[model samples]
Target chain A: MGQEMSKIEEAKNLTQNQILEELEEQLRVEEIEEQPDTIKTEEMVINFGPQHPSAHGVFRALFHVNGEIVTKIEPMIGYLHRCFEKIAENRTYAQFVPFTDRMDYVSSMHNNWAYVLTVEKLAGIQVPERAEYIRVIVGELQRIASHLLFLSTAGLEAGAVTPLQYYFDERERILNLFEKVCGARLTYNYMKIGGVRADLPDGWLEETLSFVNRLKKTIVDYDRLLLGNYIFKKRMKGAGKISAETALAQGLTGPPLRSTGVAYDVRKSDPYSVYPRMDFEMVVRFQGDNYDRVVIRSEEIKQSLRIIEQAIEQIPDGPILAPGLPKDIRPPVGEAFGHIESSRGDLGYFIVSDGSLKPYRLKIQGPSFANLQGFPAMAEGSYFADVVLTLGTLDPVFGEVDR
Target chain B: MLTSGQLLEFANTNGIPIWVLDASIALLLSLAVFAICGLGVIVLVYMERKVAADFQLRWGPMHVGWRGTLQLIADAIKLISKEDIFPKNADPWIFRLAPTVMFLAAFVGLMVIPIGPKLVVQDLNIGLIYALAIPSIGVAGIIMAGFGSYNKYAMLGSMRSAAQMVSYEVPRALSIIGVVMIAGSAKLSAIVNAQSVWYVFLQPIGFVVFLVASLAEINRVPFDLPETESELVNGYHTEYSGMRFMFFLFAEYIAMMAASALTVVLFLGGWHGPGPAYLAPLWFLIKVFAVIYVMMWVRWTLPRFRIDQVMDLGWKVLLPLALLNILITGIIMLL
Candidate 1:
């Protein structure tokens, strides 16, 4: 046992690719061994989605179960794929901002910001001070919206209906605030290559401040209703536990990784936009269980509210769009990658420009796609009900995952 | 005042043949009971929707009839007019018969409940036990539905339903034994007559255990693992549709009513409210609906418990509490 522990510790120092190769080798060797002639009953294999209520989207998985205990899970994704990265290569840099909005539709502001930030880095365009503050405000507002959606759906998945409606009421207010700035509510194509689409509308700042103030009180009520619920805590506390080593090995980021005490948020670590100026702590919990994942998101919403409040107070007056930007953005031959702490995790965009109107190659590192890798590890050997809870806590939007 | 026995005697005095009168009276009695239960289901369905809407901050059933009073009737019409679909591989007979069996289980229990003085459909010598025993038959119906559907979700749901219902029955029955012991009879009417002090005050533990166990038996929220929508889609009724689906819905509401009625009879001093003797049935109904309102309140507020957590709660918490209540009741009776 001591030798096995030392071997595992040594293996942690290896790269992810090397670990995958070793895992494949181990599987090959195990497959060649003879099976013992032991009497066993047939395990039921259930296809749990593509059209399930609690599946979050068209995500599907084959769950192999012994009665109610899930022994193995094979996650099948790409149902909502629309060749997003392929389309990005054909469209010009400025034309692709709208496409980013469709990636993580719930947090479109963050998606737009991440994409534009990458293009800004590639083009060497400088964003004005005021535009940076607006970007920060909208990004944090989008985080609150996305995390509220996570809490609502997580509650719905757990069989509590009231929280969904209550939380949606608050989310509707946030969406209205978004609509006031941009013309759209869901897929806000508001973030430009160097700045935002427009400045804050008349009284928009006051409306946002009022909404943020109201949410502070409402979040306390939500904590009493959902986070403090005995049944919810009992169901989620120790279920779907993922160790910190397993999380880091799986390349998990954002709240799912932070819940395991990693504290590696892109906003905190990379310090993009005005995040370094704002005063807020990265929400982290030491338990990598479903309960911690949920609680961390709830706490993150509070922190997002704090960031939004500070950004609103500190926002300066300036041009919303970058000055002297050409209609067709043709950057010099280069590649650049920019990441943000999206509500799900580390949302990054890598753009390769070849001194043309269109990008040579564009890749999206969607957090949901990476975060989904940790699910089977957490779900195996748990009760069948906990599988749904684990999936809810992971909060993978199929649009982002399959993109 | 208008017992079926009195009506039979009046028919005999008029020189009617006994066999003809008996058949006619039995048919009429069954029809009356069915109408009451059917109407109760409609009201309960509307009430559940309105209550849920109220909790969720929405106006429920407003467009159908005066604040959605006729919404269920419209829904019933739509269900009856729809195409009846069955899974191709499903067992045809059991698939068709499951809903009927489920509905009849609750219907039979309803017949034995003493709504008023001389108001029961058939107050048997063992009315209390009959009401408790008959509803357990619904577990068989749930199993049949799951087995016949040929779908894994329905199969899992039915297995959960069977386990939850069976495990809860022990606590449910044991909890009520305190009432039976204190009343010195299993007949529901006699039990009601004996509740001068309202057994809830005397046997509070038993009342609470019975309430929790009955919620599990009826598959209400927090114990609604059998048809947990998030986990099992529609659970045992995944393959049922059209009028067949409506039957399962009817059975659920009917079972809820039966459980509430049983709660009223056992603990809440059935028909003993301050009113005219002729208004006893009204008092009984008031208490029954009150219990049902509380059940719906709980359903919307609480999230569901997992299968194992539900089992733990039933066997570990509620069962022991029920036994202790019975033991305490026996000791008091001896003193």
Candidate 2:
């Protein structure tokens, strides 16, 4: 039996150089056979990004521009890839929760929550009601922060500066609130396997409620300053319009999908945590254009504020962590998928545990990676400026996409 | 009066020969114009940053001098010392010559504006028209710079510049006809004097068309498609750096100053406020700064338009409104 198992392993094993050589040979054959330079006479291939000001991250796009219009665009990713999936295979289940923090650093609470949610599902562990409520509060706040960032940077890409600064001020307040709660502003590794790291300190919830009340009124300032301005409307409306069919076909979710008049929010469709107990509406816009994308996000900030308020009131006094779980986190052989409505879109974490301390395999389906599939279509016939507008509206966080 | 003729006469009486006195007066006026152009830009740069900070809620340039008043001067020194680059196969002569044209276009346009009753420079016969024509020279330099840069972004930017400048010039030139008709001459000083109630009240429609077209003429935001930051990078000046870049910047601010001055002269009644006759130019300066402030306000508030949208605003909206103003002015004159 030992000899047979060794023979099977040896048959499957391939040297690193052998694998690289195979890829090199395929690339060489495809490069010649495909005639990559056939249309060099009429079209100009512009290499955009990876290092561009508004590519948002290290996402490169190869565009064939005819005059100011983009005739074709092929997005080339992987410049920021560090293989978060492969890293999960080596790290223990409980130890790898912090890795999700760096995956989408913009809203680290969502990343933290998603990984823990999956682990709890896979191990059949239960989280207390107080922990769920805390998760909901921080998750909603993180969504607000992420959307505010999206709106501000989108405004900047269209050549407006004041709105960006004004929005950053609001985000600073949220960051301060997060700091007071967890002693960490960004990439808060506060979520654990079955509960939160700690309970809320004194007066933090009241401060949060006051901030939400203030933001509810102040959010209109963005519209008065940027969205309602005629020039902004002209520049962004109908600039990179995507139909609902095209967006759904590309497996788009989050604001990009919601902007197309779909009400498919993960928090609603597949209710999780304390979300089902909360009272808030999912924001949606009819037109799937650049304008709708921004409008949806700006309106969604109000909804997040609503959710945060409800979570503060309904949170029950109970144990923060569940009991009767091994510290080592060795789950019996099983697979499970956990998803949450992340800021960018539907973020799902899949893990396969083979009755070991570490996971056998892990996969993350990031919304940004899926949302980026719709980019070439949006940018195909638009003006050069509209390309940046479209990318800004999609709000792809490269941290999640390349992870 | 401090007119050029009086200055020459004063020089002649002060023991200078007639020929020498005439040349001296001309040289002094030229020197004064250059000085105002240079110094005014420094102040404008500082004011714009300070004002932009106020609008955006940020502290802008608080380190160099008191309130960073000398920030631009330090910047000037930095720019002068940096390596002046030229792209491979770029036309050296045109690349070197382009900024001079951009600078002189605004500089020479300053010759005809009457800053005060007696502080007129050349006071040409067709002063308003000459001012209109002079800045068109910047178009040529822009195109040359774009062609000479050997970069595709520069080429597209210059192409957009050529199209935008040519299209906007029609409505801009046409709008001035209403003011000329009211003043009964194309002379800018005569236009200023004709406005008993600051023609903005009499010809409000003309003033509106003029403000819109003039904003487009100077490439202000919403009309700044040629230099659309998100689109074409830096537009026509994408490849420039060091002092050559500074010259382009200088040209932009000077054009702004000259345009705002012309707006004051045409509609605000140049130097006509209640004040000492010699100190009246201060009123002109105030009104011009007011117009510049409004321009900055519009710049900060509005996002940039696409090239097609800019072209549409020029041809479809501004041109017809300009012609309508002229038609109404003619009817009023006939009645």
Candidate 3:
């Protein structure tokens, strides 16, 4: 065992005893399960999802299960691949904003901001005061919408059917607010190269303030329905405990990483776009388990509400777009990476401009893709039902994962 | 209240021919049961959907009929009319026989279920035992479907049902024994009559054990690990479609009705409510629906348990609890 630990240490380049302890614990579990039973049961190879009800969307997980515990995990993804990066290279710099909307469709506002924030940074276009505030309001509202969905799906995948309805009801109202703002429900191409497509509609800020007040109550409703539910809590707590080291090593961002006691939110740590002005707390938990992740999302929803409240009050009136910004957005021949603390994680976009109308190459630093690297690690020894909850807690939108 | 036998006697005394009378009695009982099953399914399915919608904060099926009253009928027509697909490499005999076994188990259990004192199809002395044993027959059908389908998911689901059913049967039956002991008969009608103070008060622990165990036996969540739709994608009945799957669905709902009916008899005073003597059947159905409501509420509210955790719950917690209930009953009886 000591020799095996040393070999692993040599391979992994780790000096700490934590890895060895985790390995030892895994071995103990294996030994316990392998202890001879009256009727021996062989391991079954099971293909879960791509079409699975609880798989968020289009995630295929091939697992070898001993009764219910997942022994081997081979996660088969790319079922929702739309080739966003490839599309980015083909289209003009400003034309690809719609494509970004589809990447994380639940939080399309954030996706648009991530992409445009990069383009704005790359081309050195100054977003007007009103545009930044609108961006914050829209982005934070989208975050609330995204987290609301996360809460619903997490509860649903864990077998509670009621929370999804409540969450969706709340989400629909947010979407209504979104529609009022942009005249689009899902994929809003509302963000342009330098600024928002338009200013908030008449009384939009007042309406948004009212929405924040309403959302405070709805958020509590979600907490009551799901957070305090015994079966939900029992199913979530200690189900998918991922360590902070593995999370960081996998380049994880967002709630999946933050749940492991690391408050590495790009918005806070690496402040971007109007986030410095919006004062709010970053939610974090120590366990990095399913419960912690769920709690983190719930807490973040509250913080987002706070930010929205502040944004609405502090938002200034000015031009919704940068003045003197050319319509034909062609950045200089240079590479620039722009990232923001999106609802999911540090949603980043990297673009290489060739001094042409279109970008030469574009790379999407999607959080879902990065966070999904920790899935096989988390699901390795957990129960089959626990695997569903783990996937829910991880909350990988196939739009982002397979983009 | 004319029993089936008395109705036969009346037919014989009347100018009706012997063959016609015999056929009529049999046909009447069969038709009556079929009507109950069909109508029960329609009402219960609608109730379940509405209840689930209410729980989830959405309006259930509301387009087909007034509030989608005809939704189940449409579903039935579709299911019945749909193609009966036999999976390639399926063991055709067992696959075909599976739904029948499940359907008949549920249907036959209805024979012993007493809606009123004389409303039972065949109130055999061993009605309670018969009710218990009949449901176990469905387990074989579950295993057969799992085995015969040759689909890994179906097999996993069936195997889960096998393990779950076997483990839960002990507690399920044990909990019922307290009721049977109090009644001094396995006859379900007698058991109902025996409840003067309503055995639920005397055997609260027994009622809890019975409810929990029966939920496991019927594959309700958090005991529904076998047919976990999220993990197993419809469980043992995954490969089934059209009418065959409908049979499986019918069996599930019928079994739920049976469990509820049995609970009403054993715990709540059966068919004894605040109404006229003739309203007993209505009261009976109302109680059954109430029980079904709770089960469905639990189904939508609670998450599924891990397989091992479910086993631990059944054996370590439920089994011992059931046994303790029996011990307490015995002690109280002696005192």
Candidate lDDT (C-alpha), each: 0.92, 0.88, 0.87
> Which one wins by lDDT: 1 or 2?
1
Candidate DockQ values, in order, are 0.69, 0.45, 0.55
lDDT of 3 by residue, B1-335 (tens): 55658866777788677788778778889889989887898888999999998887789999998989999989999999999999999999999999999888888888888999778888899988899998889998899999999888888888888898899999989987788878899988888887788889989999999999889888888888768877788888899999999999899998888888889988998988886899999999888889999999998887777777778888999899899998988898999
- Across A1-403, the per-residue lDDT of candidate 3 in tens digits comes to 9999989877776645667888999999888788567457677898888887777889988889887678889998889998889988889887898888888888899889988989888899888888888888888888888898988888777777788888888889889988998899999899987888977889878888887899898788679878898867778889888999999988888999999988798888999777888778888889989999999988988898898888888888888888888778889989899999888898888989999999999998889989999998887998877887788788788899999
TM-score winner between 1 and 2, please give it.
Answer: 1
lDDT of 1 by residue, A242-361 (tens): 999999999999999999989899998999998899999988899999999999989999999999899989988878788999988899999999999899999999989999999999
Top candidate when judged by DockQ against the true structure: 1
Alpha-carbon deviation at B7 in model 1, angstroms? 5.5
**lDDT (0-100) at residue A116 of candidate 3?**
90
- Candidate with maximal lDDT: 1
Q: Model 3: residues >4 Å from true position, as ranges?
A: A1-43, B1-27
Clashes per model (N, Cα, C within 3 A) = 1, 0, 0
All candidates: TM-score: 0.94, 0.91, 0.91
* Candidates in order, interface RMSD in Å: 0.6, 1.4, 1.5
RMSD (Cα, Å) for all candidates, in order, is 12.3, 13.1, 11.6
If you score just chain A, what TM-score does every candidate get? Answer: 0.90, 0.89, 0.89
Q: Over 4 Å off in model 1, which ranges?
A: A1-40, B1-17
True-vs-predicted CA distance for residue B35, candidate 2, Å: 1.3
**Per-prediction fnat values?**
0.85, 0.65, 0.71
